[model samples]
Target: MTIKEQYVAAKQAYANWGIDVDAALETLKKVPISIHCWQGDDIGGFEVNKSELSGGIDITGNYPGKATTPEELRMDLEKALSLIPGKHRVNLHAIYAETNGEAVERDQLEPKHFENWLNWAKENGLGLDFNPTLFSHEKAADGLTLSHPNEEIREFWINHCIASRKIGEYFGRELGNPCLTNIWIPDGYKDIPSDRLTPRKRLKESLDRIFTAEVDETCNWDAVESKVFGIGSESYVVGSHEFYLGYALKNNKICLVDTGHYHPTETVSNKISSMLLYSDKLALHVSRPVRWDSDHVVILDDELREIALEIVRNDALNQVIIGLDFFDASINRVAAWTIGTRNMIKALLYALLVPNDHLKELQEKGDFTERLALMEEFKTYPFGAIWDYYCEKMNVPVKERWLTLVKEYEHDVLAKR
Candidate 1:
């Protein structure tokens, strides 16, 4: 049978086993995935579709960064969105902050900026994730000198809140918005652990203030409170622990788990299970094995990609939003993201083929051993036929484009090492 036929057959089998095949397919289709395309020398302006492989490496050579005029950015985004299908979104960091990383010195979401971004995205049918860091994760531990014990960090964080509100307002003015802000803070320790309690307290305080501001004051307040996620640089990083999440829960925040940020030994499925158990807000960061570094590249079995999908099937968690959190220095950022997303889709399909009855029976009996065994079974189960099937049905051209992307960029990425 053709690949599409195999996919139909496998999906049919899943449906017969009481799985919501249509829902699964829809969720698989609409997972909000994007890459971090920062303003840099490699990519000066924006080449949205072409950068799907290497994250738009050097595509905008000699072009101004965010220093470009608002009209310029709007024009860049307009052209970029027209090339890519669907409402393509990006996770961009705010360049406005005086933090260590590069930031836009321009006003935070000036009226002109918002009007242009809004009109262009609306006209062209696109979206922006606007993932910004409040207290730069890179500086949280070592840059204690830049902040105060209580007052300074609060001030910096609240400033982020103000900036966030302004940006959201600017965007919402154009499109009726959902999820006005995307926050991923590295507010954890790196070395010589500080008073863990203090960090949690400060973070909670900061979030409480932000939430109040967003709900009580902001114009388009449809922010997904649960999409707020944290990552610790190390395993013991403050935000990586349970207490930080507990405090977030107290203030109505959810956990977003990045696959690479967990301790190297932590499997994706286990993390998903733990995060699901403890939190109502669920978001996922998908990336591949980086050996030592986090957010390396995207590979299906590089770590626990298969099992992560199984957790989705077993838990049947539908409210979760899966997004791409890929950062690459040497290779093209967009290419890595596109390949990573496709790999994720392939893994999702494999998870779908695993008989739902088998998974349900194990869960119903409280059979941890049996459930894990079935999950492992699904992890290695062969569904190439099904994968090929969906590729044809969706006209995704998985093999050719995937191979071309991998072949062209994989060597470049490896050579940079």
Candidate 2:
């Protein structure tokens, strides 16, 4: 059957469950997933005086044809965006700043260094998000940044985060959208610590100082991310989930959750509803973790669907800031992005096609049998057909056709690099 014919049949099937496939597609189109720029270059941002990847952060797989310059990274991102079915935002780290060959310190980074990025974003009609890079720097060599014992080291990172918020506000003001400036520090002890309270206290004080900076809250929203541990800091991580959760609640900041930041058994999907109850807004870093926090590419797995379901069923689409956070240099960097991002959208589409109200009613009424049967049955429904039709409608390649485009780009543009 033709694409339209398949879509019509699928739409009718969903209609039987009181689902509106067209409406779901429309909603999906409007939702913007913040694509991380670090994926293009494997988290290797263009800094003049760049330090090696530290703070337990590591990127494996030496894929050829990686983006080496800021222009090239932006170009690769544009190429990937062409294949994805919806409009999206670009997430950038502080190290991605363009300083015209000058060794600009992290604390001194300004919006002027990102003029080209702003112009490019304006031309492409994409919103921008910011992150304060705290992992790979000399000041953080001891695997502690804001939580460091020394006053000067903590002060430098505080200034860097404050500067990052200003850049975030600048992007939001120019792009006509609020920018999410998320702060994730890799501060912890490799072994057991004699006193954990002191480091956490220092970290809390640094955060208070950073947020005290005068900036338009409407333009730039602040977020604090917590990690269980990292390569170096395995025994104890200062910015644990409880630490940031309380800080965010008290400071009225967004608590950014990374999928791979928790224990292996713990899931971010299960936490979304609870978090939403306490905070007016939340941010997500959707990543795939295999056993450890490996930062694998996202897939359309059970957890991903549950994550999407929580966002859709709760009507928190606008309240939750969705961002991708995986960097797999083993595969084609562009294709890795295309696969992960497309799967995230696919998961959302699958969730939208669910008979959520009925399922909830079944759970509430204690009708487990029917709920299980229906949920299992819907897994085999005409989800792919609806997705393909949406892709066609959005003017992107349908199904595996996009892979051919990626190969061509690899052969032409990337191969030359």
Candidate 3:
């Protein structure tokens, strides 16, 4: 059957539940998912004196056709963007700065180093986001930054974060959109620590100094992300969720929640509604974590749909900032981004097609039986029909057709590389 014909039938099914499929599609088009740049090159950013990937982060498998240069990475990203629906943003780490073969230290970085990225973003009409690389560096060799015992080491990271915020401000001003400069540090102990308060206190002081540098809020906003544990810091992590949650609330900064940064039983979907109660805005790194904090490619799973439902049902579409964060060297990198991003958008589409208001009313009236039945029945509804129509309307390849183009690019462009 034609895509439009399928959509027409699906629209009527949702309409019976008082759901407006057309309005839902319009809302979905405006949600921009920030695609992480590190996925294209396995987080190996272009730097003159690059350090080994450290701080408990690991990327397995040696995928062929990994982009080796700044231009190539950007080219690969553009390819992935074309396959995904909706206008989106690109997320960058500090190490991705281009300095023309110059050995610019982290603290010495400026906006000029990212001029190429800014120009590419402008020409393509995409928004930009930023993050300070607090891991995989000499200063963080001990697996601690900001919370380091040595004053000199902590000072270096503080300056680097300050420099990164200024660069984020530049992107916001030039692009006419506020850039989210997020900070995620890996500062923890491999074994149980004798004292935790000391490190957290030092970390708090470092953040205060970094924010004191004074960048205009109109151009840039700040966010703090926390992790439960990592490779070396299994026993303890300085930037725990509670630590950053309190800090963000007191400091008036956005608190970022990485889906993979929680415990095995803990779920990010459950925390979204509560976080929204205290703050007007929140940021997310929507990633699939397998077992531990292993950054796996996202899929349309139960948790992903619940997360999307929380955002759409609560009417927090503009309140929550969504971004993708996962890297796998086993598959095609471009295809990895396309699949992960498409699934995220697909989850949002699925949630939008649900009868959220009706479900809530049923719960309010204590009609648990009907609520459970209706939700289950909606699962078998025609969600795929609407998604296929969205792809056709957005002018992207429908269904699995995008993989064909990826194969052609692999043989023609990536094979030579």
Ten residues in a row with the worst lDDT in model 2?
226-235
Task: For residues 176-292, write the lDDT of model 3, one tens digit per residue.
Answer: 999999999999999999999999999999999999999989999999999999999999999999999999999999999999999989999999999999998999999999999
Task: Write the residue-wise lDDT of candidate 2 on 1-417 in tens digits.
Answer: 999999999899999989988899999999999999999998889899999999888899988899999999999999999999999999999999999899999999999988899999999989999999998899999898998889998889999999999999999998889999999999999999899999899999999999999999889999999999878888999999999999999999999999999999999999999999999999999999998889999999999999999999998998999999999988999999999999999999999999999999999999999999999999999999999999999999999999999999999999999
For all candidates in order, the CA lDDT equals 0.49, 0.94, 0.96
Clashes (candidate 2): 1
lDDT score, candidate 3, position 140: 93
C-alpha RMSD (angstroms) for model 1:
7.5
| Residue 123 accuracy (lDDT) in model 1 | 73
Candidates 1 and 3: which is better by TM-score?
A: 3
lDDT of 3 at 395: 97
Name the 10 consecutive residues with the lowest summed lDDT in model 1: 49-58
Report the C-alpha lDDT of model 1 over 1-417, residue by residue, as the tens digit.
665566667666556656665565565555444534442123233221121212111132231122233344343333323222234455444542222233442223333433444555577655544544444232243423112365765566566655666676556555555433555454444345646566656655665666666442233332322211223333234344365456545655545556665555666566566666666556666665354334555677734455545555655445455666554445544344455666666666566666666767788989989888866665554466556555555555546455564454335532232
Q: After superposition, how far is residue 255 of candidate 1 from its true place, in Å?
A: 1.8
> Which has the higher lDDT value, candidate number 1 or candidate number 2?
2
Error of 1 at 2 (Å): 4.7
Positional deviation of 22 in candidate 2, in angstroms? 0.9
Error of 3 at 237 (Å): 0.2
